[model samples]
Target: MANKYQRILLKLSGEALLGEQGHGIDADILDQYAEEIKAVQAEGIEVCVVIGGGNIFRGVKGATAGMDRVQGDYMGMLATMINSMALQDALERKNVHTRLMSAIRMEEIAEPYIRRRAIRHLEKGRVVMFGAGTGNPYFTTDTAASLRAIEIEADVILKGTRVDGIYDSDPEKNKDAVKFDTITGDEVLNKRLNVMDLTAFTLCRDNKTPIIVFNMNIKGNLKKVVCENQSIGSTVVWDQ
Candidate 1:
Protein backbone atom coordinates (compact mmCIF):
# COMPACT_ATOMS: atom_id res chain seq x y z
CA MET A 1 0.00 0.00 0.00
CA ALA A 2 1.19 3.51 -0.81
CA ASN A 3 1.59 5.80 2.19
CA LYS A 4 -0.43 9.01 2.06
CA TYR A 5 0.53 10.61 5.34
CA GLN A 6 3.88 10.59 7.04
CA ARG A 7 2.15 11.33 10.36
CA ILE A 8 -1.44 11.40 11.57
CA LEU A 9 -3.47 12.16 14.66
CA LEU A 10 -6.13 9.63 15.60
CA LYS A 11 -9.02 10.85 17.75
CA LEU A 12 -10.74 8.06 19.66
CA SER A 13 -13.93 8.72 21.53
CA GLY A 14 -14.29 7.34 25.06
CA GLU A 15 -17.40 5.47 24.04
CA ALA A 16 -15.45 3.43 21.48
CA LEU A 17 -13.27 1.97 24.21
CA LEU A 18 -16.21 0.92 26.36
CA GLY A 19 -16.74 -2.28 24.32
CA GLU A 20 -19.89 -4.29 24.94
CA GLN A 21 -20.15 -3.62 28.67
CA GLY A 22 -21.02 0.04 28.29
CA HIS A 23 -19.11 0.94 31.46
CA GLY A 24 -15.60 1.35 32.79
CA ILE A 25 -12.40 0.01 31.23
CA ASP A 26 -12.51 -3.32 29.50
CA ALA A 27 -9.25 -5.16 29.04
CA ASP A 28 -10.12 -7.12 25.92
CA ILE A 29 -11.46 -4.06 24.15
CA LEU A 30 -8.32 -2.13 24.99
CA ASP A 31 -6.14 -4.94 23.72
CA GLN A 32 -8.04 -4.96 20.47
CA TYR A 33 -7.40 -1.27 20.01
CA ALA A 34 -3.74 -1.76 20.78
CA GLU A 35 -3.44 -4.46 18.15
CA GLU A 36 -5.07 -2.25 15.55
CA ILE A 37 -2.76 0.61 16.43
CA LYS A 38 0.19 -1.70 16.19
CA ALA A 39 -0.87 -2.73 12.72
CA VAL A 40 -1.03 0.89 11.59
CA GLN A 41 2.35 1.71 13.07
CA ALA A 42 3.80 -1.29 11.27
CA GLU A 43 2.86 0.46 8.05
CA GLY A 44 5.36 3.22 8.97
CA ILE A 45 2.81 5.94 9.77
CA GLU A 46 3.57 7.85 12.92
CA VAL A 47 0.42 8.12 15.04
CA CYS A 48 -0.53 10.65 17.71
CA VAL A 49 -3.66 10.03 19.75
CA VAL A 50 -6.28 11.91 21.77
CA ILE A 51 -8.71 9.72 23.70
CA GLY A 52 -11.91 11.09 25.29
CA GLY A 53 -12.84 10.45 28.95
CA GLY A 54 -16.59 10.19 28.59
CA ASN A 55 -16.65 6.42 29.00
CA ILE A 56 -14.88 6.32 32.33
CA PHE A 57 -15.98 9.63 33.78
CA ARG A 58 -17.91 12.57 32.44
CA GLY A 59 -17.78 15.62 34.70
CA VAL A 60 -20.95 16.82 33.06
CA LYS A 61 -22.77 14.09 35.01
CA GLY A 62 -22.30 16.09 38.18
CA ALA A 63 -23.64 19.26 36.65
CA THR A 64 -27.17 18.09 37.49
CA ALA A 65 -25.99 17.47 41.04
CA GLY A 66 -25.32 21.21 41.42
CA MET A 67 -21.58 20.91 40.98
CA ASP A 68 -19.88 23.95 39.49
CA ARG A 69 -19.50 23.49 35.77
CA VAL A 70 -15.84 24.34 35.73
CA GLN A 71 -15.03 22.04 38.62
CA GLY A 72 -16.97 19.27 36.97
CA ASP A 73 -14.98 19.87 33.84
CA TYR A 74 -11.73 19.53 35.76
CA MET A 75 -12.97 16.16 36.94
CA GLY A 76 -13.47 15.29 33.30
CA MET A 77 -9.84 16.09 32.61
CA LEU A 78 -8.76 13.72 35.32
CA ALA A 79 -10.93 11.07 33.73
CA THR A 80 -8.91 11.37 30.54
CA MET A 81 -5.76 10.60 32.50
CA ILE A 82 -7.19 7.22 33.41
CA ASN A 83 -7.88 6.35 29.80
CA SER A 84 -4.47 7.59 28.76
CA MET A 85 -2.73 5.36 31.26
CA ALA A 86 -4.77 2.39 30.14
CA LEU A 87 -3.84 3.01 26.53
CA GLN A 88 -0.20 3.46 27.39
CA ASP A 89 -0.17 0.14 29.20
CA ALA A 90 -1.95 -1.62 26.38
CA LEU A 91 0.39 -0.30 23.72
CA GLU A 92 3.43 -1.11 25.75
CA ARG A 93 2.18 -4.66 26.21
CA LYS A 94 1.99 -4.95 22.45
CA ASN A 95 5.68 -3.98 22.30
CA VAL A 96 4.77 -0.69 20.66
CA HIS A 97 6.83 2.32 21.76
CA THR A 98 4.49 4.80 23.47
CA ARG A 99 4.49 8.12 25.34
CA LEU A 100 1.85 9.59 27.62
CA MET A 101 1.69 13.38 27.69
CA SER A 102 -0.75 15.30 29.79
CA ALA A 103 -2.06 18.80 29.26
CA ILE A 104 -2.71 19.33 32.99
CA ARG A 105 0.90 18.55 33.96
CA MET A 106 1.06 15.43 36.08
CA GLU A 107 4.82 15.72 36.14
CA GLU A 108 5.48 12.43 37.89
CA ILE A 109 3.33 10.26 35.67
CA ALA A 110 3.53 11.81 32.21
CA GLU A 111 5.28 14.53 30.29
CA PRO A 112 3.72 17.98 30.23
CA TYR A 113 2.14 19.15 27.03
CA ILE A 114 5.09 20.22 24.90
CA ARG A 115 4.78 20.46 21.15
CA ARG A 116 8.42 19.85 20.38
CA ARG A 117 8.78 16.90 22.74
CA ALA A 118 5.69 15.26 21.33
CA ILE A 119 7.03 15.68 17.82
CA ARG A 120 10.34 14.18 18.81
CA HIS A 121 8.61 11.16 20.28
CA LEU A 122 6.56 10.79 17.10
CA GLU A 123 9.70 11.03 15.02
CA LYS A 124 11.07 8.10 17.01
CA GLY A 125 7.92 6.15 16.09
CA ARG A 126 6.33 6.30 19.51
CA VAL A 127 2.58 6.64 19.79
CA VAL A 128 1.87 9.78 21.82
CA MET A 129 -1.38 9.87 23.78
CA PHE A 130 -2.42 13.45 24.53
CA GLY A 131 -4.29 13.49 27.81
CA ALA A 132 -6.47 16.21 29.31
CA GLY A 133 -8.77 18.44 27.33
CA THR A 134 -6.55 21.14 25.93
CA GLY A 135 -5.69 22.02 29.56
CA ASN A 136 -8.96 24.01 29.58
CA PRO A 137 -12.40 23.46 31.03
CA TYR A 138 -14.65 24.29 28.07
CA PHE A 139 -12.92 22.64 25.13
CA THR A 140 -13.87 19.13 24.05
CA THR A 141 -11.38 16.43 23.05
CA ASP A 142 -12.51 16.90 19.46
CA THR A 143 -11.09 20.40 19.57
CA ALA A 144 -7.99 19.15 21.34
CA ALA A 145 -7.49 16.63 18.51
CA SER A 146 -7.73 19.45 15.99
CA LEU A 147 -5.37 21.70 17.92
CA ARG A 148 -2.83 18.93 18.39
CA ALA A 149 -3.10 17.81 14.78
CA ILE A 150 -2.17 21.34 13.71
CA GLU A 151 0.53 21.79 16.32
CA ILE A 152 2.10 18.47 15.38
CA GLU A 153 1.84 19.32 11.67
CA ALA A 154 0.10 16.05 10.91
CA ASP A 155 -0.64 15.35 7.27
CA VAL A 156 -4.20 14.38 8.16
CA ILE A 157 -6.51 13.66 11.07
CA LEU A 158 -8.20 10.29 11.14
CA LYS A 159 -11.28 10.12 13.30
CA GLY A 160 -11.90 6.54 14.49
CA THR A 161 -15.63 6.50 14.99
CA ARG A 162 -18.38 3.95 15.50
CA VAL A 163 -19.91 4.79 12.15
CA ASP A 164 -18.15 4.06 8.88
CA GLY A 165 -18.63 7.57 7.49
CA ILE A 166 -20.63 10.80 7.63
CA TYR A 167 -24.36 10.76 7.09
CA ASP A 168 -26.96 13.35 6.12
CA SER A 169 -28.72 12.56 9.41
CA ASP A 170 -28.38 10.15 12.32
CA PRO A 171 -28.30 6.77 10.60
CA GLU A 172 -29.23 4.93 13.76
CA LYS A 173 -32.25 7.12 14.44
CA ASN A 174 -33.26 7.94 10.88
CA LYS A 175 -33.12 4.91 8.65
CA ASP A 176 -33.47 7.03 5.54
CA ALA A 177 -30.36 9.12 6.22
CA VAL A 178 -27.93 8.93 3.33
CA LYS A 179 -24.33 7.85 3.92
CA PHE A 180 -21.74 9.90 2.12
CA ASP A 181 -18.68 8.10 0.82
CA THR A 182 -16.93 11.42 0.22
CA ILE A 183 -17.61 15.08 0.87
CA THR A 184 -15.94 18.48 1.06
CA GLY A 185 -15.26 20.41 4.25
CA ASP A 186 -17.29 23.37 3.07
CA GLU A 187 -20.25 21.14 2.37
CA VAL A 188 -19.90 19.51 5.77
CA LEU A 189 -20.07 22.95 7.36
CA ASN A 190 -22.79 24.38 5.12
CA LYS A 191 -24.96 21.31 5.45
CA ARG A 192 -24.44 21.24 9.23
CA LEU A 193 -23.20 17.66 9.02
CA ASN A 194 -22.30 17.72 12.71
CA VAL A 195 -19.69 14.93 12.32
CA MET A 196 -17.70 16.96 14.81
CA ASP A 197 -18.38 19.97 17.03
CA LEU A 198 -18.54 23.42 15.45
CA THR A 199 -15.21 24.51 16.87
CA ALA A 200 -13.37 21.39 15.69
CA PHE A 201 -14.86 21.59 12.22
CA THR A 202 -13.99 25.27 11.84
CA LEU A 203 -10.48 24.69 13.13
CA CYS A 204 -9.80 21.92 10.59
CA ARG A 205 -11.28 24.02 7.79
CA ASP A 206 -9.21 27.06 8.69
CA ASN A 207 -6.06 24.99 8.94
CA LYS A 208 -6.78 23.26 5.63
CA THR A 209 -6.32 19.87 7.29
CA PRO A 210 -8.08 16.93 5.75
CA ILE A 211 -10.06 14.53 7.96
CA ILE A 212 -11.03 10.89 7.46
CA VAL A 213 -13.98 9.43 9.35
CA PHE A 214 -14.07 5.67 9.61
CA ASN A 215 -15.18 2.74 11.75
CA MET A 216 -12.32 1.78 13.99
CA ASN A 217 -13.98 -1.40 15.20
CA ILE A 218 -13.11 -3.02 11.94
CA LYS A 219 -9.56 -4.29 11.91
CA GLY A 220 -6.97 -2.56 9.69
CA ASN A 221 -9.06 0.52 8.87
CA LEU A 222 -6.53 2.90 10.39
CA LYS A 223 -3.72 1.46 8.29
CA LYS A 224 -5.76 1.89 5.13
CA VAL A 225 -6.45 5.53 5.83
CA VAL A 226 -2.81 6.37 6.42
CA CYS A 227 -1.81 4.62 3.21
CA GLU A 228 -2.22 6.45 -0.11
CA ASN A 229 -4.01 3.45 -1.56
CA GLN A 230 -7.75 2.81 -1.51
CA SER A 231 -9.31 3.50 1.88
CA ILE A 232 -12.45 2.16 3.55
CA GLY A 233 -13.61 5.48 4.98
CA SER A 234 -14.95 8.80 3.77
CA THR A 235 -12.29 11.42 3.16
CA VAL A 236 -13.38 15.01 3.83
CA VAL A 237 -11.35 17.83 2.34
CA TRP A 238 -11.77 21.41 1.15
CA ASP A 239 -13.76 21.63 -2.10
CA GLN A 240 -11.40 23.25 -4.54
Candidate 2:
Protein backbone atom coordinates (compact mmCIF):
# COMPACT_ATOMS: atom_id res chain seq x y z
CA MET A 1 0.00 0.00 0.00
CA ALA A 2 1.18 3.51 -0.77
CA ASN A 3 1.39 6.16 1.92
CA LYS A 4 0.01 9.68 1.78
CA TYR A 5 3.21 10.85 3.42
CA GLN A 6 6.51 9.05 3.30
CA ARG A 7 7.64 10.53 6.60
CA ILE A 8 5.82 12.33 9.39
CA LEU A 9 6.61 14.01 12.67
CA LEU A 10 4.04 13.10 15.31
CA LYS A 11 3.71 15.49 18.24
CA LEU A 12 2.05 14.07 21.33
CA SER A 13 1.03 15.86 24.48
CA GLY A 14 2.27 14.60 27.82
CA GLU A 15 -1.25 14.96 29.12
CA ALA A 16 -2.36 12.44 26.52
CA LEU A 17 -0.10 9.89 28.22
CA LEU A 18 -2.15 10.22 31.39
CA GLY A 19 -5.29 8.72 29.89
CA GLU A 20 -8.14 9.08 32.46
CA GLN A 21 -5.78 9.55 35.34
CA GLY A 22 -4.98 12.97 36.77
CA HIS A 23 -1.19 12.56 36.44
CA GLY A 24 1.75 10.30 35.53
CA ILE A 25 1.98 7.67 32.80
CA ASP A 26 -0.90 5.33 32.01
CA ALA A 27 0.36 1.91 30.95
CA ASP A 28 -2.73 1.15 28.92
CA ILE A 29 -2.44 4.38 26.97
CA LEU A 30 1.26 3.77 26.32
CA ASP A 31 0.70 0.24 25.08
CA GLN A 32 -2.24 1.26 22.92
CA TYR A 33 -0.23 4.10 21.38
CA ALA A 34 2.70 1.81 20.72
CA GLU A 35 0.46 -0.64 18.91
CA GLU A 36 -0.99 2.15 16.82
CA ILE A 37 2.47 3.44 15.94
CA LYS A 38 3.68 -0.02 15.05
CA ALA A 39 0.73 -0.43 12.75
CA VAL A 40 1.76 2.77 10.98
CA GLN A 41 5.33 1.53 10.70
CA ALA A 42 4.15 -1.76 9.25
CA GLU A 43 2.55 0.32 6.49
CA GLY A 44 6.08 1.48 5.49
CA ILE A 45 5.86 5.08 6.68
CA GLU A 46 8.71 6.64 8.59
CA VAL A 47 7.75 8.12 11.98
CA CYS A 48 9.41 10.55 14.38
CA VAL A 49 7.85 11.72 17.64
CA VAL A 50 8.05 14.71 19.96
CA ILE A 51 6.14 14.63 23.25
CA GLY A 52 5.41 17.53 25.60
CA GLY A 53 5.78 17.60 29.38
CA GLY A 54 2.68 19.49 30.49
CA ASN A 55 1.35 16.43 32.30
CA ILE A 56 4.42 16.54 34.49
CA PHE A 57 5.33 20.21 34.56
CA ARG A 58 4.86 23.51 32.77
CA GLY A 59 7.52 26.18 33.12
CA VAL A 60 5.11 29.05 32.63
CA LYS A 61 2.74 27.64 35.23
CA GLY A 62 5.63 27.10 37.59
CA ALA A 63 6.76 30.69 37.13
CA THR A 64 3.25 31.88 37.84
CA ALA A 65 3.47 29.91 41.08
CA GLY A 66 6.68 31.76 42.06
CA MET A 67 9.30 29.20 41.04
CA ASP A 68 12.50 30.16 39.27
CA ARG A 69 11.49 30.19 35.64
CA VAL A 70 14.71 28.77 34.19
CA GLN A 71 14.88 26.05 36.77
CA GLY A 72 11.26 25.20 36.18
CA ASP A 73 11.77 25.08 32.43
CA TYR A 74 14.71 22.74 32.88
CA MET A 75 12.54 20.57 35.06
CA GLY A 76 9.90 20.65 32.36
CA MET A 77 12.51 19.50 29.81
CA LEU A 78 13.41 16.63 32.10
CA ALA A 79 9.76 15.72 32.24
CA THR A 80 9.73 15.44 28.46
CA MET A 81 12.76 13.17 28.64
CA ILE A 82 10.90 10.94 31.06
CA ASN A 83 7.88 10.79 28.76
CA SER A 84 10.11 10.11 25.76
CA MET A 85 11.91 7.31 27.58
CA ALA A 86 8.59 5.79 28.60
CA LEU A 87 7.40 5.88 25.01
CA GLN A 88 10.67 4.35 23.79
CA ASP A 89 10.37 1.56 26.32
CA ALA A 90 6.80 0.79 25.31
CA LEU A 91 7.60 0.85 21.60
CA GLU A 92 10.67 -1.33 22.10
CA ARG A 93 8.63 -3.86 24.07
CA LYS A 94 6.41 -4.12 21.00
CA ASN A 95 9.54 -4.98 18.97
CA VAL A 96 9.57 -1.56 17.32
CA HIS A 97 13.03 -0.03 16.86
CA THR A 98 13.16 3.44 18.44
CA ARG A 99 15.84 5.94 19.40
CA LEU A 100 15.37 8.50 22.14
CA MET A 101 17.31 11.71 21.43
CA SER A 102 17.49 14.64 23.79
CA ALA A 103 18.32 18.26 23.06
CA ILE A 104 19.71 18.67 26.57
CA ARG A 105 22.53 16.15 26.03
CA MET A 106 22.26 13.59 28.82
CA GLU A 107 24.27 10.90 27.05
CA GLU A 108 23.76 8.55 29.95
CA ILE A 109 20.08 8.31 29.03
CA ALA A 110 19.59 9.61 25.47
CA GLU A 111 21.83 10.47 22.59
CA PRO A 112 22.42 14.20 22.11
CA TYR A 113 20.46 15.82 19.34
CA ILE A 114 22.13 15.25 15.96
CA ARG A 115 20.20 16.26 12.88
CA ARG A 116 21.94 13.92 10.45
CA ARG A 117 21.83 11.00 12.85
CA ALA A 118 18.12 11.40 13.42
CA ILE A 119 17.39 11.51 9.70
CA ARG A 120 19.51 8.43 9.23
CA HIS A 121 17.58 6.63 11.94
CA LEU A 122 14.34 7.31 10.08
CA GLU A 123 15.90 6.20 6.82
CA LYS A 124 16.68 2.89 8.52
CA GLY A 125 13.00 2.57 9.55
CA ARG A 126 13.63 3.28 13.23
CA VAL A 127 11.35 5.70 15.06
CA VAL A 128 13.12 8.69 16.57
CA MET A 129 11.75 10.40 19.69
CA PHE A 130 13.02 13.93 20.45
CA GLY A 131 12.85 15.21 24.01
CA ALA A 132 13.95 18.21 26.13
CA GLY A 133 12.35 20.96 24.15
CA THR A 134 14.92 23.23 22.38
CA GLY A 135 17.40 22.89 25.22
CA ASN A 136 16.41 26.39 26.19
CA PRO A 137 14.08 28.11 28.60
CA TYR A 138 10.93 29.98 27.43
CA PHE A 139 10.60 27.71 24.38
CA THR A 140 7.96 25.00 24.20
CA THR A 141 7.94 21.41 23.07
CA ASP A 142 5.64 22.61 20.29
CA THR A 143 8.51 24.69 19.00
CA ALA A 144 10.88 21.80 19.42
CA ALA A 145 8.56 19.56 17.43
CA SER A 146 8.29 22.14 14.69
CA LEU A 147 12.03 22.66 14.55
CA ARG A 148 12.76 18.97 14.47
CA ALA A 149 10.12 18.34 11.83
CA ILE A 150 11.62 20.99 9.62
CA GLU A 151 15.12 19.75 10.24
CA ILE A 152 14.11 16.22 9.26
CA GLU A 153 12.10 17.51 6.28
CA ALA A 154 8.99 15.71 7.41
CA ASP A 155 5.99 15.91 5.11
CA VAL A 156 3.70 17.14 7.90
CA ILE A 157 3.39 17.64 11.62
CA LEU A 158 0.87 15.17 12.91
CA LYS A 159 -0.31 16.81 16.10
CA GLY A 160 -2.00 14.05 18.03
CA THR A 161 -4.40 15.73 20.40
CA ARG A 162 -7.49 14.58 22.24
CA VAL A 163 -9.65 16.82 20.07
CA ASP A 164 -10.94 15.55 16.75
CA GLY A 165 -9.92 18.83 15.11
CA ILE A 166 -9.29 22.48 15.62
CA TYR A 167 -12.41 24.27 16.88
CA ASP A 168 -13.32 27.93 16.85
CA SER A 169 -13.80 27.66 20.61
CA ASP A 170 -13.08 25.13 23.32
CA PRO A 171 -15.29 22.25 22.21
CA GLU A 172 -15.33 20.67 25.64
CA LYS A 173 -16.67 23.84 27.20
CA ASN A 174 -18.83 25.08 24.33
CA LYS A 175 -21.13 22.52 22.78
CA ASP A 176 -21.82 24.86 19.89
CA ALA A 177 -18.18 25.16 18.82
CA VAL A 178 -17.45 24.55 15.17
CA LYS A 179 -14.65 22.36 13.85
CA PHE A 180 -12.68 23.15 10.73
CA ASP A 181 -11.73 20.50 8.20
CA THR A 182 -9.04 22.82 6.85
CA ILE A 183 -7.73 26.12 8.10
CA THR A 184 -4.98 28.58 7.16
CA GLY A 185 -2.15 29.54 9.46
CA ASP A 186 -3.22 33.14 9.23
CA GLU A 187 -6.73 32.40 10.45
CA VAL A 188 -5.39 30.34 13.29
CA LEU A 189 -3.16 33.25 14.28
CA ASN A 190 -5.63 36.07 13.63
CA LYS A 191 -8.22 34.37 15.83
CA ARG A 192 -5.67 32.99 18.31
CA LEU A 193 -7.08 29.48 18.03
CA ASN A 194 -4.05 28.17 19.96
CA VAL A 195 -3.55 25.20 17.67
CA MET A 196 0.16 25.57 18.36
CA ASP A 197 2.56 28.07 19.83
CA LEU A 198 3.13 31.11 17.65
CA THR A 199 6.75 30.11 17.15
CA ALA A 200 5.83 26.67 15.91
CA PHE A 201 3.02 27.90 13.67
CA THR A 202 5.17 30.60 12.16
CA LEU A 203 7.96 28.17 11.47
CA CYS A 204 5.61 25.85 9.60
CA ARG A 205 4.06 28.71 7.69
CA ASP A 206 7.46 30.04 6.67
CA ASN A 207 8.68 26.59 5.70
CA LYS A 208 5.44 25.64 3.94
CA THR A 209 4.99 22.51 6.00
CA PRO A 210 1.40 21.45 6.65
CA ILE A 211 0.16 20.31 10.04
CA ILE A 212 -2.62 17.83 10.76
CA VAL A 213 -4.31 18.03 14.14
CA PHE A 214 -6.17 14.83 14.93
CA ASN A 215 -7.66 12.62 17.62
CA MET A 216 -4.80 10.25 18.37
CA ASN A 217 -6.60 8.27 21.06
CA ILE A 218 -8.64 6.64 18.35
CA LYS A 219 -7.17 3.26 17.39
CA GLY A 220 -6.83 3.45 13.60
CA ASN A 221 -6.76 7.19 12.97
CA LEU A 222 -3.04 7.36 12.30
CA LYS A 223 -3.15 4.71 9.62
CA LYS A 224 -6.30 6.26 8.18
CA VAL A 225 -4.58 9.59 7.77
CA VAL A 226 -1.26 8.35 6.40
CA CYS A 227 -2.16 5.15 4.58
CA GLU A 228 -5.75 5.59 3.42
CA ASN A 229 -5.63 9.39 3.03
CA GLN A 230 -8.78 9.72 5.09
CA SER A 231 -9.85 13.05 6.52
CA ILE A 232 -9.73 12.40 10.25
CA GLY A 233 -8.90 15.89 11.46
CA SER A 234 -8.23 19.54 10.66
CA THR A 235 -5.29 20.35 8.43
CA VAL A 236 -3.51 23.63 9.05
CA VAL A 237 -1.45 24.89 6.16
CA TRP A 238 -0.06 27.96 4.42
CA ASP A 239 -2.82 30.18 3.08
CA GLN A 240 -1.40 30.10 -0.43
TM-score of each: 0.95, 0.98
lDDT of 2 by residue, 173-200 (tens): 9999999999988889898998998898
Candidate 2: list runs displaced more than 4 Å: none
TM-score of 2: 0.98
Task: Compose the digit string of candidate 1's lDDT tens values, residues 1-240.
Answer: 468788999999888888888798888878988998898888888998999998977767777689987898888888888998999999998899999999997899999999999999999999999999799987889999999999999998889988888999988899898888889988888898977898988899899898989998887777766764666778898855
Candidate 1 error regions (>4 Å): none
After the best TM-score superposition of candidate 1, give how far the Cα of residue 101 lies from its true spot, in angstroms.
0.5
Per-residue error (Å), model 2, residue 194: 1.0
Best by lDDT: 2
The positional error of residue 113 in candidate 1, measured at the CA in angstroms, is: 1.0
The residue pairs found clashing in candidate 1 are: 2-228, 4-228
